[model samples]
Target chain A: MPITRRRLLTAGGGLALAGATAAACGSNTGRGGGGSGGSLSHWYHQYGEPGTEQAVRRYAAAYKKTRISVQWRPGGNFDQQTAAALLSGSGPDVFEVNGPTLDQILGGQVVDLTDLLKDVKDDFQQAVLAPKTHDGRIWGIPQTVDTQLLYYRKSLLDKAGVRPPRTLDELVDAARRLTDRRTKGLFLGNDGGAGVLGATPLHAAGLSPVTADGKVGFDDPAAARTLAKIRKLYEDKALLLGAPADWSDPSAFVQGLTAMQWSGLWALPQITKALGDDVGVLPFPADGPAGKPAVPVGAYAAAVSARSDRKAEAKAYVRWLWVEQTGYQEDFALSYGLHLPARTSLARKADRLRQGPAAEASRFAAEHGHADPLLWTVASKVAYQDALSRIIKDGADPEGQLKAVVRTTEAELARVRKRS
Target chain B: MPPAALRPLTSNTTRRQRNRTLWFWVFVGPFAVGLALFTYVPLGWSVFLSFFDAHNTVTPTDFTGFGNYRRILSDPEFRSSLTTFAVFTAIIVPATFALSLALALAVNRLRWAQAFFRSVFFLPTACSYVVAALVWKMSIFNGVRFGLANTVLGWFGAEPVAWLATTQPPWYWLVIGTVRLWLQTGFYMILFLAGLQRIPVRLYEAAALDGARPGWQTFRHITFPALRATSVAVALLLVINAFQAFDEFFNLLSDARGYPPYARPPLVYLYYTALGQGQDLGLGSAGAVVLALVIAVVTVVQARWSGLGRKEE
Candidate 1:
């Protein structure tokens, strides 16, 4: 028998109603049981190639006693998925939150993790924990920490007859000498926005856009100087216009088209895959006359949904995956060969990371890195992007653009504060 | 004599009429309820929300009366978005209409394997927008040398163009328009083909017998009035889709934050305002309400201009 639209509608409505009723009744089949140790649902962003799925299932099987079911959803537009789930109160119990938006998510409905990780909190990197904490209340546990590093094609550098730059002046001179009309010494597409523009340069210059107090601190003279250097690079044709910071893939460095690419440690695997053993990693050049090289520190956070009824189980699962068994570090190395453990202790203990180039880069990034603290605000992302676009597309003055961004951000912060 | 003069009233006719009316209502009732629940109810809610400062995320707190609408009126971003939206609609609507009509006419002339040809044309409409966008972004319209479009361009001695990365506005618009055409033209073509079939062949034959050429005949009668209704429907649909253009732009462009100069369609901006950055539900809802009104007005204007609702005399 052919189904009519009316019949379909009736069936759908009836099913939805029944589902709602069942949900309200706290159906044990789907819903996690907290203290009784039933099934726990853990959602994570997908990673690795084809073999990664097998590794994840193996990891899940190893931790079967936790009764946790790991559902790895591919990481593309995760915010939309999370938002929809949050509204319907059916979001994953445990999920990933970006470093910058850590506080905002926490403020909304994120479960507090202060008491949950009281004993083990200090064991993790302070930088990782900083963004996840608000008013001394821990809202999330760090899963992985990332930091920006300069990726160079060793063969390209050698072919160009230039050594890696040790100082800012030396770097500029090297870039100038190395650059030709067909190829650039450095490739950055900062036209997309401020985050892309600011991330590498600000870190290299030893400046932070946001301070510990969640205030706008991006208007530093050092930041201006860095922007000036970028402008000079563009003027000299030392940087590729084709690979605008907004749209250019960092993989250009791996593809041997560019001499240097400034990105995070995550690109190591990709670079390794593309260029094989011909890539060399280095920290971005130091800003001051005699400062150490620096990179921007970024962390991925894991948090329990505020709407989740199985908060305890979710927290327990996070502790297990991220803290207890060193599962996160293992997964990071074995699965994607991308991430570094957020916990310093775990990084030291993980044999897989210690034996690879990823470990070396992670350790370098961690010791000398800056993290953006203005992540909790909406204006930061937009303002950052707009500032970059203005600078690249309209040839707007960097100082003026940065100041505008700060002004806009300050106003947004005030508005949000007032609303609260 | 009085009983004979008084004719017996037939109850069967009245009973049959009552049954037909009941059946008609039964069919209409489901749709009426659906319309009330999904359309009118949400629309009413949206209009109500527009009066206050309503956010789309968290719990909407502030209730500044007409604050959102006033802000929207003065906002440069909103003005730019409206302009962008208008340009996008204007380009896509007429281009899609002409292309679909041409395709329909071509397909209608085919005798052998008509169904296969029709299916081939409509295949893109069935593909998910996400899949299509990804494929277009990665493979076909790839900005790099590896892309199919660039490979074809290479044959003509042209360098690979960064379709997504270029600061050039016209190129960006062209790329977006091409994708939209690829996805939407097929569905509209089928609609036009159906309308073409409904056009009486006798009229064309009569026009031909009158010594009128094929193109002239089509221009005079067969093509003009026959496509009027389909054009109106397609125009309205295109306008609605243009305003609601999010999935392709969002997926293909922008980062995790959904920031500007990429996918920041007004709806995307509204979405970001609500969920991405501010978590402000009020501003987003207010933006949505404004967008709805804009779409409604545009669609109504098009429908009126096209004489979509006018009955044949």
Candidate 2:
């Protein structure tokens, strides 16, 4: 009790010890109970569609078994945040990934969810399941399939006397002819088609992202030529450059800023609401002798974390929300945004998708759709995308860029192979 | 026996020193612990992780010594990011220094509404970088005819240009540079204003009496030289800040698709490599360590050149 120096030192040390003990006892991340007990943390990237957050939260609220806390991570950094959180052992117990990456699959960041789909595996679309599987184990449950293709205004094309392009050259010419004092021909993003169309040209040229044996599949010379055609569109300034929104939203097309825009099936409802029957859908047109018209199909899949302490509960939550709940799945795909139901049966039963541009889009997706290879990592994708940007925006030699990308892709493939 | 009186004084002095020491520990101890825990611990852990094969996990048993460093060094993308950083620094540092100094000089010379001008100029400093980048991307520099820049160009019968696109002219540099300048120059201007006010009025009067010209000559002889210390400090800070630039570039160019390869700073690139889908923390940590070294060397070299902490003669 005396104000002695020794007493002060002792008191300080004791306080420090007590503080450390309290801090250690506290939760690392403020959102606790993901590891144990009655609560679970579910994360989804901020979907651009209105009511997406409300809808996901509504679904979470319906689950009576466990208290599900949904963290709607905003912006494009969801993958980064998920990866970091997983590494730190503080990530969501159940989460949504665009698809399971090689890192997530190989490193055991995601648990094998094939057990959830065992009985109903045949009902789900194979294209949606392919990217989520590794070594015959499904790492994720397909929630919604987003098909990226071209959306054009029928009225604008009719006014300009431009038919829906069936070939890459025709698409370019149509884009050129549609440009005038006000409206530009097409919009493929602010980067002049780099973000969305980067891989499209490869698919348009009939090149696979990766070979069946896991080799770099986009190294052919024809791949470069297809990209060069995109550059021609850029050079002509026919492609609508920067709009308020990027190519993801159908804003450019709906606002009549561009006659045609590259967007996903998710934007179909908004586009239909804005333009009605005047809107038309087309696959990115075929290029070269071996080419076929193509649509890039991607899916947002629900994956449970392997490192989650409550793995069984998380899996049950995933299974309950994505598997047993067909109504919620259909609503997630159709009501909030227009995406194809991951279940083939649900897609078949959906009356809305059976008519109009949706039907055309679904047909194109089945006929000409190309899903990215499971072996192709995000690093390879970034490299390939950068090559496309350089080719289209900067007039860099496509052959050279593609060659460089091949090296990067091969290295990534080798790394994955080594790990596996 | 003769020094007995002085012994009590000595004892009192010792007690006062002890009390001061105890108070110092009380004030500084908590902050020192926090600094160690938050900053130094992570820094040390990062260095340790740089030598491991930490792909998706932080704790790793596989020690791949120098492999991550080799990969980062050999990576063309990382090298390209370094080049981008260098170009950004070269553009931003001089432009910011000159503009901020000019603003300070202008505001200092104003006899009326100086406070108003200062506040007006300083307001952008309060705006978040992400918000400003969004405004710049969505409204001002957007390539559409309705965008502010394009609309202005339209009045002159000019075609709308994609200001952020990697076109032949590379107008994105202008957009990035201008936003940073607008955001940062005000803060530095305030620093220069403080430096300006600190100068003795007698020196300027003496310079005027010595037949120095009022505008350029007096500025060169008196004003510029007097503000050397502030100038050095500001330039050093600007250089470091430029190297660490992230939020604006990340917000403006990056999206769900990807970042354009051209303007990616090291930190953004590292964020993607270490934390993005690749989740290769080892390689990312190596890049970070290398970046930190580069920043440290640059800062030291700049301080040496500018004589930043040297005593004025």
Candidate 3:
């Protein structure tokens, strides 16, 4: 308490050193509970929309059986953080993932939820459960169903005297026709549309890239043509290049940067709020001769870590939150941003998906939504991504690229099969 | 009396020596621990991991024995990513060096407002690479009609260009490379300025007296030679820094899950392999080890070429 020079210097130096350490190490005061009082800890990647963190906390607070601590980690490097945490055996008891990869399931990191799924198996949509169900044992319970599709400006198309394209060739032409001094027609995504391009063609062709077996589904000549046809859109300058937002964000479409954009169902409410009746939705139009209009369907699944100390409690929490608690599931799906409930019964009954693009999106997702095969590996995906980028953006031969992809895909499939 | 005095002196000397030894360990301990924990340990573990097929868990299962290294080398994406990084460094290093040197020379000569100008130039260094990337991507070079670059293009009767999205003509390189230049030039400029100030005033006066002109002559005869060591160090740093390029490329040119082939650098490629959907820690660790070796070799080559350790008379 003395105001001496020695005391002042000591205090100041100590405070400065402490501040520097905190800055360098980035305050380890994370939000998740550190097992104080033996509470259950859950982790979620930070959602962009407001009230999501609070909503999760509100759910955790409702559970009086145990104190549940939740950490809403900042997005961007969530995968790295989650993986590192899980690897160290200090990860959350319960967490959510886009879906369990073959690696996660094979690594024995995720616990099987077959017991929870035994009765409620048919209640969930099959497409949503495709990734979660591997080796005939369900690993994760479905959390939210997200599907990607094209959101178009009906008014802009009408003014330009263009109908929504039903085929890849038509899409190319329509994109070119819709182009003017003011607007370019389509935006699949900023990175030469590679985000959607790799999967959409397969989806449109009514084929998954890799089947349950290792057979190549996207090796069709028409699929090759579809890849090549995208070149026309690029060559003609019909595609809008870079926008601030990615495909997940509806900002580009709402702002009228492009007349039509490939976006997700999660953006339905946001797009409707922004553009109202001017918006219309369609699947990634058929790319191959035998294809149908299709969309890429994805979902986040609640998984209990095998390494969790409270594995049983974590499973119970997951079951209660994602399965038994139907009301919370609906709220989680629709109230914040639009995502169809994983439950088929609840999804169809939800009022938001009862009409318009919401209804259409849900219907299409149920009927035609394509999930990337559970066995798909990063190498195989990259092979397709590179092939697609080259064919569309760099004027490479599509058939040749597809063949190259087939070779790589087969190799990767073999590697994973042997390893897993 | 002499014996008493000698013992006291010896004890005092011994205490001073002991204090110095204690201080040395105290100061070096934290840094030594940090280096081993974060850097050396990780590197060693990574080398160990390169031999096996690891997944989500750091603990590897299969003993692949250089399989990851062989596989990655054969993988076209990894090879191309390395090439892309090489090209990126080639373009960025020279542009940054020249611009920084010019700016430094200009700042060093200022009789007044030198601090103001230096601060203005150095302001960009204060901004986060990711934040700067977003600004560049969203506002300045965004494909929209009202973007700053587009607005300028429109004035010149050119169509608004989708800078980051374009891959055919490699226009995206222009956008990404420029942001790298803008974000980095300031820090390097400060270095050059420091180097400039260290140059003896007599050298410049000597050059001036020897009929060395103001523009190039002064720089060629005096400034450039005096800053040779600094230039070599800056160049070496530039290459290493360029190889670690991630934040700008990642933020500016990537989608939800991965970067396009054109935008992929070696580190990003490794990330995709290691952690992206498949979560192959083995391949990623192998890639990282290989990359570290590459960086080490490049640094050594540069240091040797620049005569880094050779004593200059």
Candidate 4:
């Protein structure tokens, strides 16, 4: 008999031994189905909200014809565990990826969902489409989009007599103005985003981290200028180093820890609840002569397992859930949490997203949002972050840092080619 | 009489020996099964996987002998991680031993409520490593001005320090190091306490009668030599635990997104390579195999130095 996901999970192997307690705690392993023609398995990372799990199970249950087993894995180890399952030949038939990576595509682990997506393909925002497309084939169906931008306190900026920053220079000036013994201005992350926004600044400089053609594209001198600017901000005491929490939670912003914070759209509701009409959002300030304001848009997309024997069935389920059923998709996005549905028409219908800063953020995400290339490996990503750390924090030469990053990225691209 | 002669001397011995063999396996069965399944099997698989180029991580179809090992051996990050772990081990082992030994000595001489003091110290040992690390990361050593460490420092006319973020001054090491020391020292103290109790009261009496002092001289001559086996065992345990450090580093040193490479030990580095954004299992396994080898060599040297396996009279 072929090894099924259940046998591999329940048999107490390595994953079972390691993550079994986490699995037993929140996972819905008993979702009433196996791989019959209408049966499929799906997996999701843990969402902290109370009802998110039930919402997913309810969505899966609506398709009475198909028996879909949903596994809500705990967050930290989800990616690793999913990779292990996929490699073990016992992966979920249909699953979600944060974004399409080159390894998934080259491993042939994900199927091209484009053929079935023709009907509703155009309705997806540009932010959702660019990252999922590799070699002109759409690897995943964008479920909902997540965008990170600057959330500023209007009261604090007004008190400092500073207008909302529109450029990198303006941001630095505003940050210094807002800085005092009481509060700092901006909080990117705990590590000053040494790893997080290393490539994002490149995006703001009208540069992408790397090209899909296997060339280093973020080596521009403008990126160096951006790094230098960040260092100046650091020297001015315009940044918060450590907070009680990371940037993902709205607590830092809500608790008045900083004048402004860089965070995702998911935290919008909590921030709004704490300080009504006091909060405003802006895309990361553009840099360089060629630069434009931008938001880095990432999404969890639904894709079929290429190795699944029921690839056709899995593809149909993916289409039915993410594309065909707009109501469930809308509910999946808006009802559970503050997320923009992948479909443009659906996002337009979200009342909370239709007005004020929400509308502006939505528009900015669609227009200025950038996607990571499929071929960029995790090692290259870490290298980019390290390069930024060396340049901005350690005062190392920017050109040298870029060259080191370039060398590693080229090796990663070569590795992809060899694997493919 | 002819049948008895034909049966020979082997018949009874064979039956008895077979029964004893069967009983031996029966008694040791669960332990053997658990060891094979959890420990040895994964080890064998990791060694096997080190020879293959695996993408999915589980199924290794491509046989590239020694390629994975060669890749990890040359990687600068892997080498840096080893050096970091070496420093971490050096600090933790002696520190843990000294703290535990001191606590054990004090508790051994206690005239009343000895159990209370012992229980209080050992409470943290019973706490989970992840939970303890998180408590330290969030409550005590958090980078805010109001955090426990910073609050105390502020009273001294010093500005609040970013205890976890000051990488240049290496303040983060104190955060990670102190939490580990607090969590583990108590358990080792218990071991030392057991060893302390085993020393004969008559020996101390005799040393005193011979004009030996009640403090340093007596401890050096009597207590120290008497706990040799326990000290060796404790040191070995400390070395192994230090090398395998993961839970504390991961929980304390990482942000919500992921860990920075500033203070990762070998296990955490291998985890990222294998399971973190890049699922390069072959390379990760190779790194693991190499780490296991390092740990094994260190353990063997330590054991030999301590005379761990030698027969004691």
Clashing pairs in 2: none
Instruction: Name model 3 segments beyond 4 Å from true.
Output: A1-36, B1-9, B201-214
Candidate 1 residue-wise lDDT, A269-334, digit = tens: 667877778877777777664345766676767778877777777787677766787754566544
Comparing 2 and 4 on lDDT, the stronger one: 2
Instruction: Tell me the spans in candidate 2 whose CA falls farther than 4 Å from its real position.
Output: A1-36, B1-15
For all predictions, the C-alpha RMSD in Å is 5.4, 3.8, 3.5, 6.0
Model 1's C-alpha root-mean-square deviation from the true structure amounts to: 5.4
lDDT of 4: 0.82
Top lDDT hit: 2
Model 1 alpha-carbon miss at residue A142, Å: 1.0
Q: CA lDDT of B236 in candidate 4? A: 93
Q: Model 1 over residues B75-180: C-alpha lDDT tens digits?
A: 6666777777777777888899889989998899999999999999999999888888877776776555557887898889886666765554446676678888
Model 2 lDDT tens row, A200-238: 788888888798788888879899899899999998889
- Better candidate by TM-score, 1 or 3: 3
Per-model DockQ against the true two-chain complex: 0.28, 0.68, 0.64, 0.52
Docking verdict class for candidate 2:
medium
Return the lDDT, model 1, position A12. 81
Best by TM-score: 2
TM-score of chain A of each: 0.80, 0.92, 0.91, 0.88
Q: Lowest-scoring 10 consecutive residues by lDDT in candidate 1 chain A?
A: A240-249
